[model samples]
Target: MEDLMQKATEATDDLYRIRDTYFPKDVNHKINTLQTHSQIALNILDSIPLEERKLATQRATYEYLRGKILDVFEEYSKKAEDHLSKAVKLNPSLADAWLCLGNCIWKKGDLPATRNCFTLALSKGPNKRILSQLSMLERRMAQGAENQEEIVAESIKHAKEAIALDVKDGNSWYNLGNACLTCFFVTGAWDHSKLQQSLKAYQNAEKDEGMKMNPDLYFNCATVNTYLENYERALSGFEAAALIDPCLNATEEVKKMINLVDKLDGLLKGQIKAKRLASLTSSLTEVQVKPSYKRATIDNLLDGLNKAIAVVGKVLFFIKHENITPLYYLVCDSNQICFVLTVYGMSNEAIKEGDQVTLLDPCFRNNNFSWNEKHYELRSIRVDFLEQVQVNGKPIPPRHSVRSSIYAQHKP
Candidate 1:
C-alpha cells in the first residue's frame, strides 16, 4: 500500500517536470504513466477501509492527477471529471484537482460548471495556466452572447489578466491574439490595430520551439496576413500549415490565392481585359447607379434567410467566386460576418479592397462554423451602395477562409 502511494506521488511529480512543454506526445507519455499508477492506487484504495482518512486522502491525490491526465482525450473525460471531483471533495486544498476537474467538465460542454471549478481552484491557489484557460473559455462565451459588448469586455478583462500573470506562457499569448481579433471584428475597429497586435502575439507564441508543431497557430498567422493583404506571406504560412495537417486542403487554397494574385497582376499589366479592372475598382457614386433593396444588419437578417435583405458592413478581404456565370465575392466584414456577394460585370467594378459596401437583396446561407475556426455567412450581393473610405488611417483587405469542408465541395 505504501509502495502504491509512493509510486502514485512520483508519477504526478514526473508530470510537472515537463509540464511546460507543448509536445502532445511527450505530455501523453507522462499522462499514460500517471494513469497506470493511479489505477493501481485506486484499486488498492477500494479494498482499504473508508474510515482510514489519511490513507484515503493520499490515494485520492492519485485519483485527482489521473483525472487530469485523462482529460487529454475526449473518451476518458467523464472518468476524469468524476475522479477529480471526488479528489477535490476529499481535500478542498487540492487546487490542482479542482483545475483538472474544470478541464474535464469543460470538455463535456458544461461551461458554467467549468468556470465554477476554475474559480474554486483559484481560491485555493493561483496558477497561470489555469487562469489562461479560464480566460479563453470566457472569451468564447462572450462571443455567443447577444449583449456582446458587455460579455466581450469581461472576456478581454480576463485575457489581459492571464497575460499579465505570465509573460512567457505561449497559450496565454495565443489566447490574447484570439481575443484581440474578436474585438476587432465585434467593434469594427477602423484602423485594424488589433489585427497587428494579434499578429505580434502569435509571433511571440511561436518563439516557443514546441509551438512550431501547432497547425492552428500557422493557420491563424496566415489568416492575419490575408487581412493585411500580405499575399506572399499568407501563401507561405498556408503552405507551412498544410505540411503539418494535410486534411486542411491548404494546398488547394494556395492555388486559388495564386490565381487571385495572377489575375490582379494580369489586370495591372493590361494582359487581362480592361473589363476586369472595373470589377477590381468600381463604386456606386462614380457612375449612375440606383438601389432597389432595403438595408439591414447581419444580426437582423438571420431570421429571413434567402430573402433580399441588404446588409452593410466594412470590407476586410475579398475572394473571387469561380466559374459561375455572374462573378461572386466572398467577403469578410469588420463586424464579424462574412458573406458571398455576387457582382454583375459593371457592378463588379465598384467592389474594391477596404470598401464599406451594402449588399442589396443579399441571400444569407450557412457556413460550417466549427467553434474555433474562421467562417463566413454565404450571401449573394446586389451592389446597391459602396463607400470606399479609410478608417482611422489604417485599413487592410478584409479576411476570408476558404479551406473549409464546404469550400472543398465547391472546388473553385
Candidate 2:
C-alpha cells in the first residue's frame, strides 16, 4: 500500500509538470497520458483491501490522489469534487487535498469557494505553492471589476508572500512578474515604474534553471519590454517564446513589431521630399501652452515622468492597428524629426493627418534596433489623457473620450 501511494504521488507531480510546459500540439496526447496515469492510480487505490484502508489517514491519502488525477481534466468533474471533499473530511490535516479541491472548484467558476479552500490549505501551514495559486486567483478576479486596482494590488501582495517563502523558486517569481504586469495594465499603461518592476521580476525568474522550459515567461517578459520600447529585447524574447511554443501568439507579435518598424522607416525615408519638407518645417509659429506648461522638444525627452510641457508637431499620417488603445500616428516636429505618436483616452477621429497637434506631457522613448541585418531607429511618444493632446489648437471634445479596449484586429 505504501509503494502504491508513492507511485500515485509521483504520477500526480509528473502530470502537473507536463501540464505546465507542454505546447498546444500535445493536448490530445497529454489528455490520453493523464487518463492513463489516473487509471493507474485508481487501480492501485481499488486494489488495496477495504480492511487495510480502514484507517482515516490511509483512506484520505487514497481519496486525495484519485481526486488530484480527476482534477487534471480541463472540465470540472463532480467525481473529483466528491473524492476531494471526502479526503478533507476524513483527515482535515491533508493540506494538499484542500489545495487540489481549490483548483477543482476554480474550474467550476466558484471563485469565492476556491478562495476559501486555499485559505483553509494555508491555515494548515505556510505553503508557497498555495500562495502562488491564491495570487493568480486574485488577478483573475480583478478582470473587469470596478475595484480592479485594489484586487490587483492584493494579487501582487500575495505573489510577494509566495516569493518570500522560497526566494529561489522560479514559479513564484514568475507569478509575481505576472501580477505586476497585470497591475501595469490595470492602472493605465502609463506607469513605467510598474513595467520596470515586472521586467526585473521576470529576470529573476529566469535565473532558475527549471524555468527554461516555460515559454510564457519569455512571452510576458517580452511584452513588458515592448511597452518600455526595448524593441531589440522584445523581438528576441518573442522569438525565444515562439521557438518553444509555435502555437502561441509570440510569433505574430514579432511579425507585427518588424512590420511596424518597416512602416516607420518607409514613412521617414520614402515620402519626405526636400521641397515638401521645407514647406512643412516653415509652418511653425510661436505657440501658447497651458498656464503651467513648459515647452520642450523631442531631443530633450526623458523615459519616465517629464515636466509639464508641450511639443508641437504636424500629423504626417495615421498608423492604424485594430482596436488597440492609444491610436498610433506618425508626426514630425518643426525640425523635420519624425516620431510615432500614440494618443489614448480618445477616439481615432479626434486627430487626423495634416493636423497640427500639441503633445502635452508626452511619454517618450528612443527605440533603436536591428532585425534580420536591417537597422531601424524610431523616436516614440505617448499621451495617456485626451487633455494632453490639442488638435488645431483646441482641446478634444469630451464626446471623443472612450474607455480603452482591445477587441479585434482590422484595417482602417
Candidate 3:
C-alpha cells in the first residue's frame, strides 16, 4: 500500500516536470505514461475498502493531478473543474490546484470564478507565473469594462510586479508586453517609448527557454509591428507564428492581418512618388489625443451653416483633376449620411480614401438638397496639423499626384 502511494506521488511530480518543459519525443511519452499511472493509482485506491486505503494529503494531490491531465480536453473540462475544485477544498494550500482550477473555469467562460481561483492561489503563496496569469485575466476583463483605462492601469501594475519579482520569467515578460500593447490600443496613441518598451520585452521573452514553443508570443510581436507601421516585420513574424502553429484560436485574426497588410502594401506600391516620413509625424510631434473637433454627423454638415461646430467623417473616394491642386473626397459617417469634404494645402499630404478623421471649425457652404446635387463642401477648412491628415489605416507617406495631361471635369 505504501509503495502504491509513493508511485502515485512520483508520477504526479514527473507529470508536472514534463508538462512544464514540453519538448523531445520522450517527454510527451513520459507525460502520457505518468498520466495513466496517476489514473490507475486513483482507481486502485478507490477499489480498496474504505478503511484499508489510508489516503491523506495524497488524496488531494492525486485528484489535482488527474484533473490537470483531463483539463487538456474540452469535453472533460467540467469534470476536470469538479475534480480541481474538490482538490482545492480538501487542501486549500495547494497553489497548483488553485491555478489549475482557475484555468478550468476561465475556459468555461466564468471570468469572476476564474478571478476568484487565481486570488485564492495568490493567497496561498506568491508566484510570478500566477501573478502573470492574473495580469492577463485582468487585462481581458478590462477590455470589456466601461472604466477601461482604470482597469488597464491595474493590469499594468500587476504585470510590472510580476516582472519585478522575476525578470527571468518569460511569461511575466510576455504579460508585461501585452499590457503595454493593450494600453496603446485603448488610448489609440502613438506612445512611441511605450511601444519600444513592449518590443524590448517581447525580445527578452523570446530569448527565454520557456517561451520557445509559444506561437502567441510571436503573434503579439507581429501585432506590435503593425501598430508601429513596420508591415514587413509584422508579416514575417505572423508567417513564422502560423508555420509554428497553424491551428491556434488566433489563426483567423492572423489571416485578417495578412489581408490588410497585402492591400495596404499594394496601395503603398502605387504611390511611387511618395516620400516616407522620418516618423509618425512629418515635422510636428505625433498627436493621438482627441482633437478639438466636436463629434458631428454628416447631417450636421448638410444642415444650415454652423461656424461654431466641426464635423468628422471617413473618405470614400477622391476626385482628382488637373485644374484642382487638392483632391475632393466623398466622405460618409456611420449615420449613412454623405458629403463632399476636401482640404487646401494638403495636396502634398496625399489624403486617401478609407481615412477616418475629425474636422475642426468647419462651416457648411450649402444646405440645398436637389436630385442633381451630389454633395456639400467645406470652404476655407482649417487643418490643425499636416500629420493629422493621416488616419489609423496602414500608415502611408504623403504624395502629390495630378492628371496633368488631361483637362477634364468630374463630379465629386
Top of the candidates by TM-score: 2
| lDDT of each residue in 267-378, candidate 1, tens digit only | 3233434454344434422322125545455546663333544455545345553432234454443334445553422233345666656554554433222212422223
Residue 360 in model 1: lDDT: 49
With candidate 1 superimposed using the best TM-score fit, by how many Å does residue 306's alpha carbon deviate from the native? 38
List the global CA lDDT of all models: 0.56, 0.82, 0.60
| Model 1, C-alpha of 1: deviation from truth (Å) | 8.3
TM-score per candidate, chains pooled:
0.59, 0.89, 0.58
All models, RMSD in angstroms: 12.6, 3.4, 15.9
Over 4 Å off in model 3, which ranges? 1-55, 249-412
Backbone Cα, N, C clashes tallied per candidate: 11, 0, 0
* Residue pairs that clash (backbone atoms under 3 angstroms), model 3: none
Model 2, 311-375: lDDT tens per residue?
88888899875336557898888777788897755677889998989888887877667889998
Q: Which has the better TM-score: candidate 2, or candidate 3?
A: 2
True-structure lDDT of candidate 3: 0.60
